[model samples]
Target: MPDSHLHEPRDSTLVDLHQDLPDAARLKRLGVVIAVGAVIIAGAGIAWRSHSVGTETVTAHAAAVSDVAVVHPAPAAPTDDLVLPGQVQAWNSAAINARTNGYVRSWLADIGDHVHTGQPLAVLDAPEVDQALAQAEADYQTALANRSLAATTATRWTQLLTQDAVSKQETDEKQGDLAAKTAVANAALANVKRLRAMQGFERVLAPFDGVVTARAAQIGALVVTGNLNAQPLFTVADVHRMRIYVHVPQTYSAMLHPGIVASLDLPEYPGRTFSATLVRTAGAVDVQSGSVLVELQSDNTDRQLKPGAFTQVHFHAAGSVGTMTLPGTAILYGNDGPSIAVVGADGKVTVRLVKIIRDDGNVVRVTGALNTGDAVIDSPPDAIHNGQNVHVTQVLPAVTAAKAGARAK
Candidate 1:
């Protein structure tokens, strides 16, 4: 029975070995398992790749829609005015000084005193001039007496010659002596006249109708005649009108004429504008300043405007070129000179070349191949290029181009 059992186990082990060995079904099953695993891995890889590609596409789309600020160019006027610095001055000013040596006796006028032409401003006590006048008078009288005696002697000599009481030579000598005495008398008379004229200067008089802007005259102040080193007695200014001197740039020189209208603005009188007429201009340009000196006159009958005041002169100029103004931030300075970033209606960025006319800190005046309807990018990015897509984050309010032009006027 034990032998029978061993034989049966052996037979079973053989059957099991055959089953575990490579069989068609088993090999087919193993191949099927490997094929299923490869299919599943390929499907997973395809899914992961699709997901990564989708994420990348979304990220790229997000980057393409960049937010940018956009603004519309301000409407520009056909004509723009120019404002320039000017110097205000008196129409006519003079420094009054002593014409003759004297001491200040009394001043009839002080600073801020308005007087007429030939009006006495001060009285000067000129002792030397008085003495000289007196001496000149005495000399003139003596010369007159001598001239009279010479005339009488000359007449008598001629009469004597006719009577043959004296020689012709002696008569001629007497006539010559009389001529010499007459010339001396004439010189003395001239000296007397000169002294008298100089004495008249002792009364300091106004040269014209004007106001005394300054006075240095004091009681008993000694003044030398024609002394350039001496301080002036008074400063007389014709305040009936005021003169403004402006150095206009050569670019605008052609627009200026003798009658061009200009307005004056002063710091002292804010909001009060004075109308001015162009009086004259230095036709030639100054090499040093590269500008023309223009003179303008304004009526100051009320004496409101004063001399030597800082002023702003506004010149109305007509613009012939199509110019536009934009905010300063819209301008972009690049290697290709000044340029601006413009946005197309389709939201494409396009850089344009521009010519700048003026810069007023926050505003810029530009002229180029641009239209009023074009949108300009404010504070453009450094890497911005032409034909780049942009997404406008905000549309700034329309800036008034007329304000800058108005200020020019």
Candidate 2:
């Protein structure tokens, strides 16, 4: 009955309102759920990205660096060598001192005077020594006379005792006296010789063929002998050969021996270099300086080398084989470890750990899984990473001596 009465309702109203009611209500609920779910999902995504390690992150600036050329290690064959900071010195420096105390009567030579081995340098008025020698000689003469007399007397007494003219006891006494006189004579003669020998000490003679570098003695001056603490009156150095002393680093002490070849340079002569051979060394390193002292000698018959001049030395080490050298910039030293960034055949970057042997300012010597022909990145920036695709460009600038000097500075 109600359905029949619905005929009274408008047919257009029933059709329109009923058809849209169910769909409109369902669509409203669905929109609200979708909005809430979208916001929750977005918050979770932000949290996840923040804690993950593989996510994008930014870093600060890294240390600035330079690149160096790589070369091979030194071979084990003998090669020319050198050292730094050497000194030019005399082969033999002799300080002539007064052997006896006396007044200087006259000086025969002064500084810079060329002298022979036995050339007289100075003269002393040692009359006291001469007088002592004379007195000793007189005493020795008297002793000899007495000894001769005693010998004759002893011989006469022995003959008299054999003939029973003198008593045995008396002959024994004479024999003893003779022997005593002979001993006294011999001692007196020895004293005379010693005093005579000292007479020549008044004259100072050159110890060897050299130059007189000093003159402290003057006429009428009193000098003392064996005063080691005082300065010498004359200094003589052998000019034929020169000694170059250098303080080698202690780390290289073990590598040096008595005989080794090296090159030497003097500051006075910038372009001239002389051949120097290692003569001797301290054989041990100093605890304080971490260095060893080495002595070298060079032939200077032409008088080319001079003493008291500063010089440089270059030492050749034995068994030095070279290695493939690269610029120091290629080595990336960090708290993590020592590593290098290498480019693969596929144009990709692969960082590897390596061992560095030596670092010469311009080049860093290293050994690893690198080949000689491999392309290395010079002066790489810190932004590079492992497994990165990179384009390599070989950049080499013509370096001058001035530029090298700046880098060294």
Candidate 3:
């Protein structure tokens, strides 16, 4: 046996080394497992972060969209009555002005007095006209005397010429003098006639059978003739019938004819309607107002209706088929003219151009590519445009909106 202790130590050392080798292999496998777990956790964290960022971006975009309320267009009523404000006037009105210049001596007719045709309304004390007439008569008589003397002289001269006592030239001269005197007499007579006519105008007369509605002439008031700025002496109006002037819109101008009958409502007589007959129309639409002026006549035998009174006119206006009406606020005015914002089922906006038929402040009548069930934005934003995405906050019914518009009216 060669060194038993040394051999034992070497064998122990070898066994220990073998056991450590297995431990080292286990440790290496453990490190590999740890590294794989770390890589998987990092990947999960990064994916979760990216998903959270995407969700935030989507929420921000949704919050930025505009919200709006929508309403549906309502069907226009058929056979709708058109009511408009009208003015009441007299059938025949005249402003009685003085024909000649004079002082008003006396007034025979006062305001509210009914006078007949050619009735004297006032008498004027025109001293100047009287003096002129007297002078004209005196001049006319002087001219007549001169004409008589010239005629006698001419007859005497003709006799002398026949006997050769005077030359033919003398006889011709006498005849020419007579002719000149006759012309002067005729001129004076014409002047006298003119002055007499002026004298006849001393009494202001009524032009027709009517009631005196105004009296501007007072006793001793001096009147002037041919003056445009002068006020009339009296205002006479025929009250047997009344005239009503109504401005019918161009849309309803076709329905207004001469034989059409309408009703009038006066605030003075509540609940009472006066029957009126359409007498005439302007025949053309007024450019400024886009309406036709119509004249209607109403019998005022009882004299209940007065001139210059405000009244309401009502007509049975014919309605057009397939007409649509919407709230006036829904109309959008842009460079392309009038349009409306329509929302589709996908919440996308499609701006459709429209033609405005009428606007009654609360409601508007239009014709365009629109339906009864299509949603229209009410009071759309100015920036709202075509292809815009909008979130609808409320949807109003067509009937309810119509009733509301009617109430607003």
**Best-performing candidate as measured by lDDT:** 3
What Cα-based lDDT does every candidate model obtain? 0.85, 0.73, 0.87
Residue 336, candidate 1: alpha-carbon lDDT:
91
- Give lDDT for model 3: 0.87
lDDT of 2 by residue, 58-153 (tens): 321111122323222222223424356878888788888877778888999988888999899999878788899999999999999999999999
For model 1, residues 15-118, the per-residue Cα lDDT tens digits are 34345666787788778889999999999999999999999999998898678887787656666567899998998899999888889999999988889999
Number of clashes recorded per candidate? 0, 29, 0
- Model 1 C-alpha RMSD to native: 9.8
TM-score of each: 0.65, 0.66, 0.72
Among these predictions, the greatest TM-score belongs to 3
Put down candidate 3 lDDT per residue, 1-409, tens digits, no spaces: 6877655645433334234467778688678989999999999999999999999999988976679999898877765566789999988899988878899999999999999999999998888989999999999999999999999999999999889999999999999999999999999999999989888899989988889999998999999899999999999999899999999988667656897778899988999999988899999989999999999999999998888899999876555566688888899999999899999999899999987766666677777899898999999987888888899999976643347557976
lDDT of 2 at 13: 36
- For model 2, state the Cα shift of residue 254 in Å: 6.2
lDDT of 2 at 11: 54
Angstrom error at residue 89, model 3: 2.0
